[model samples]
Target: MTETTPFGIDLELDETVAEGHYSNLAIISHSTSEFIIDFAAVLPGVQKARVKSRIILTPEHAKRLLRSLQENIVRYESNVGKIVIPVPSSPGDTGPKMGQA
Candidate 1:
């Protein structure tokens, strides 16, 4: 079943998609017109992490997503306290690097 939101877009979520995937890392790459984001899960002692989901968005949509995330994060921190990101322990341990195409 699909429902129409106030924006007049019909949205549908199947059972499988509703369960969702867990991702600890995201790799972002972009070209002039589009952006590609790969979501992955990395486990301890695992040598390699596989990309579980890949989302491709146009540059305009990607910018919208960035703004939406910034707004939501402000609201989230207001209620749940500030979210902290830990610095890398070593220079070589920098996490999640973005790539260009």
Candidate 2:
């Protein structure tokens, strides 16, 4: 049986999913009832980018996730230091990797 947590239930991570996907970019689209997030990798100078993973969440769940991420980011910065986001050198430059436009 899966154990229960104060916030929710325990999650089981399979070997395949535990490895995780490497996503350099994320594309998000939403409708009236749900939101879709597509994770992808964009290599520098490459014209095409492939979507690695897609996750669909309800509007309420999405908002909860946003808050969770915000809290985690604050804690992470407090422990490791502020994350420096790099600015692209050119207008069209999309950083180290330039995936699908």
Candidate 3:
């Protein structure tokens, strides 16, 4: 069943979608019109990681997502201390690698 929000939008979640995928790595690529984001899980000692989900958004919506994330991250850090990111071990290694399409 779908629930109507106070703003009069209907939101629905199914069983499979409610049980979400776990993603530790994200690969992002963009073209002239759209942005593609691939979510993957990388396991320790695993040689290869498969992308579990791919999301495509328009350039404008992608920017909106970026802004929303920034705002949420600020609020999260305020409540749970600042999150620290580790530096890459090697010069060739960059954290959370991004690719161009």
Per-residue CA lDDT of model 2 for 1-101, tens digit only, reads: 34567879797767788789899888888899998888888787798989999889999998998899899999999999998877887897655342222
**lDDT, residue 41, candidate 3:** 84
lDDT string for model 1 (1-101, tens) is: 57789899999978888789998888888999999999888777687999889999999999999999999999999999999878889997865533322
Error of 1 at 58 (Å): 0.5
Could you give me the TM-score of model 1 versus the true structure? 0.83
For candidate 3, lDDT tens digit of each residue in 1-101?
A: 57888889999978898789998888898899999999988777687989999999999999999998999999999999998877888986654444424
TM-score, every prediction: 0.83, 0.83, 0.81
Model 2 ranges with Cα > 4 A deviation: 1-8, 96-101
Residue 67 of model 3, lDDT score:
95
How would you order the candidates by TM-score, starting with the best? 2, 1, 3
Clashing pairs in 1: none
Against the reference, the lDDT scores of all candidates come to: 0.85, 0.81, 0.85
TM-score of 2: 0.83
Model 1 vs truth, CA RMSD: 2.7
